[model samples]
Target: MGMRNHELVPLQLIAVIASLKHGGCHKVLRELVRYKLVAYDATARRKSSNNEGYRLTNLGYDYLALKALSSRDAIYSVGNQIGVGKESDVYIVANENDEQMILKLHRLGRTCFRQLKNKREYLNHRQAS
Candidate 1:
């Protein structure tokens, strides 16, 4: 059988934790929890407070696999960094392969309360206007 794309988010989350920073799993998982991209056993025994590790949902795996293949080329540019949500920094990455895609790197080890407050303020201003 061919490789699937659905496991990307969870696998990438794991990869980011394991490779980028060893202690980033909780931070990464917090950001991805809302994406509905992981299938995990809720009943799995917890080894500690940080025992919950994610397994890739079919969609999550597929996407990460694709990204691993595509992003192998030299980076073309870090075009622009747009703040998509509280937990992500979105960048436009163009590569030597002549492909351009949005790369959303999760902001681990930060609180998003400030972003939430700003969003609320913006909404309140719009309502008052």
Candidate 2:
């Protein structure tokens, strides 16, 4: 996703980009807002139309950056976004070796938990065998 300085993203757009259903997106956004991790502007306007939108708070940005840094592989730099889906975004990144790699960041939530759980179980079972 392109960085917009203090940009507010609509709920619908967030749902589409995060690959989340409306209900799930609402739930997650509510929680984030409650925690002060995301800022919500219900009176925000664009093109003279009022709309509700969300933006990451400083805390949110810092949390994401820390998470990325804690990955197993040392990341040199995060480059452009390559793809986006309902639940994640794929980005081009440089590793410690300076080799380009694709980084997929998942935006899992209540709606996607079951799917991820099943996949994890399957992988674990396969590995055990």
Candidate 3:
């Protein structure tokens, strides 16, 4: 999911959440639900068996705001969008610590485990060569 400084729709926000490392999206959702950080959204439907829909609770919005701030720091203050790999866009970002880091924004729109594995192989080949 790509980051945008402005507000994001639920699906786009979900995409951003899903892009994080670890089971962060699920963890966040579970915690949010437990903490009542979410509200039922009548508009969004759960089309896919794997994904369910909910609106952010007040706390959820705060969390998303923080994420947006972080993403803005990464994109604006640091290096701009540099390159697009097969599955992700690579950006060079400087954190508050002033350390340069690579932000790999996954293209969740086209993400699949099978395709990811194949792309990993390609990356490995390039690195090895």
Q: Top model by lDDT, which number?
A: 2
Q: Which is the winner by TM-score between candidate 2 and candidate 3?
A: 2
The true-structure Cα RMSD of candidate 2 reads: 15.2
- Candidate 2: residue pairs that collide: 18-86, 18-87, 19-86, 19-87
- Candidate 1 — worst ten consecutive residues by lDDT sum? 1-10
User: What digit string (tens of lDDT, one per residue) describes model 1 on residues 1-129?
Assistant: 011222123444566546756447656665666686555544434366333345555446445644674677545556776666755567777877768888776543236654534444323333222
Q: All predictions: root-mean-square deviation over Cα?
A: 13.8, 15.2, 13.4
Q: After superposition, how far is residue 34 of candidate 3 from its true place, in Å?
A: 31
Q: For candidate 3, give the lDDT.
A: 0.54
Residues 1-129, model 3: lDDT tens digits:
222221223544675656754456667666777888675444422265343356554456545644895876643344778998766667777777778877666563254755434444323333322
Q: What's model 2's lDDT at 32?
A: 93
Report the candidate with higher lDDT, 1 versus 2: 2
The models' CA-based lDDT, in order, is 0.52, 0.70, 0.54
Q: Pick by TM-score: which candidate is best?
A: 2
Could you tell me which 10 consecutive residues in candidate 3 have the lowest summed lDDT? Answer: 1-10
Question: What ordering of candidates by lDDT runs from best to worst?
Answer: 2, 3, 1
Q: Candidate 2, TM-score vs. the true structure?
A: 0.50
